[model samples]
Target: MNKEYLIRWIKAAGIRAIKTMAQTAVATIGTTAAMSEVNWVMVASTAGLAGIMSLLTSIAGLPELKV
Candidate 1:
């Protein structure tokens, strides 16, 4: 792919990753009974993992983008 396509893919992947991370974090936080009892570290780690997975998935092939 050319530089433009590559750049677009990267930007899209990054946004996807951020969205995934936010979703994961929110879901994880929801699992807790109360906000005060939430484990910030665990939520962050889980979200970070999700973001990495998103990026990896993008590398494989972004379903949202057509070939």
Candidate 2:
């Protein structure tokens, strides 16, 4: 397993996580707008988790793993 490969994997994962978070955020907002009363807490919680995942993935990508 090359270090560079691991780094690349981490970078890819980070990108994916970010994209997923964005999509989820958009969907949640759209749904909330459509509904009169949305579970704000749930939406916030999920978004928070996604944000954390994105951050972790980004940090992992930062490590200069031998690619």
Candidate 3:
């Protein structure tokens, strides 16, 4: 892949990863979750895993990916 395509893919993947992380964090937090009682480590790890999965999935196919 060319530099331009690589850049575009990175941007697309990054955005997707961020979105996934946000969604995961919200879901993990839940409506009844208390801030003080929240499992911060669990939430962070779950969100991080979701983001990483999103990034890996983007490698299979993404709008910005030429191939």
Candidate 4:
């Protein structure tokens, strides 16, 4: 793969990871007393899901932006 393609993949993955983490955190906030008490499994699963989604989207050549 080319350098530009690799950079795009990395950017997409990072964006996905952050978005997943935020969503997971919001979902966990109501059930947990503190951030430290949040479920590890949920966090890991969210990350994994984000990674898979990013990879799939990248491969599918989906537009990352629209205006």
Candidate 5:
């Protein structure tokens, strides 16, 4: 329940989310490159979802700070 611990956890979650987003982006790009037919809408949706998830996770993790 320490504030520092909570901050660390939040930071870790943010970092993890960012990392996941990067990984997903790379995978999608690679797949699209290999497959001539890529869905722009799907890619946009995926990126948006990933960003939302990252923000949500970061926010949720903030509660641990008890601030």
Candidate 6:
């Protein structure tokens, strides 16, 4: 692949990662008082889902809205 394509993929992945982490953190930490208790499996699953979504969007492009 070209450098530009690689860069796009990296950017997409990073964005997805950050979004996933934020959502997971809020869900886990916002409702609980225990800061030390965290679910690693749930975090990993969220990351994986984010990665897959980003990859799919990058490859297929986003759908256009219809008026």
Candidate maximizing lDDT: 1
Off by over 4 Å in 2: 37-40, 48-67
| lDDT digits (tens) for residues 1-67 of candidate 2 | 6777766876776667777777777778779878876777767777768877776766655444434
Q: Which stretches of candidate 4 lie over 4 Å from their true place?
A: 33-67
lDDT of 2 at 65: 44
Cα lDDT tens digits, model 4, 1-67, are 7778777777876786577667765666546646467676776676567656666665655376321
Q: Compute each candidate's TM-score over C-alphas.
A: 0.87, 0.59, 0.85, 0.50, 0.58, 0.49
List the pairs of residues colliding in candidate 3.
Answer: none
> Candidate 6 residues 1-67, lDDT tens each?
6777667666765676577667765675544436566666765676567656665665654233111
Candidates in descending lDDT order: 1, 3, 5, 2, 4, 6
Q: Rank the candidates by TM-score, best first.
A: 1, 3, 2, 5, 4, 6
Candidate 1 per-residue lDDT, tens place, 1-67, comes to 9888888899999999999999999999998636668898999999999999999988988876776
Candidate number with the higher TM-score (2 or 4): 2
Compare candidates 1 and 3 on lDDT and give the better one.
1
Candidate 6: segments with Cα more than 4 A from true spot: 34-67
Against the true structure, candidate 4 reaches a TM-score of 0.50
Model 4: lowest-lDDT 10 consecutive positions: 58-67
RMSD of each: 1.9, 6.0, 2.5, 4.5, 4.8, 5.6
TM-score of model 2 vs. true structure: 0.59
Full-model lDDT for every candidate: 0.91, 0.71, 0.87, 0.65, 0.72, 0.61
Q: For candidate 3, lDDT tens digit of each residue in 1-67?
A: 7888888888989999999999999988883286456787899999999999999998888965666
Clashes (backbone N, CA, C under 3 Å), per candidate, total: 0, 5, 0, 0, 0, 0
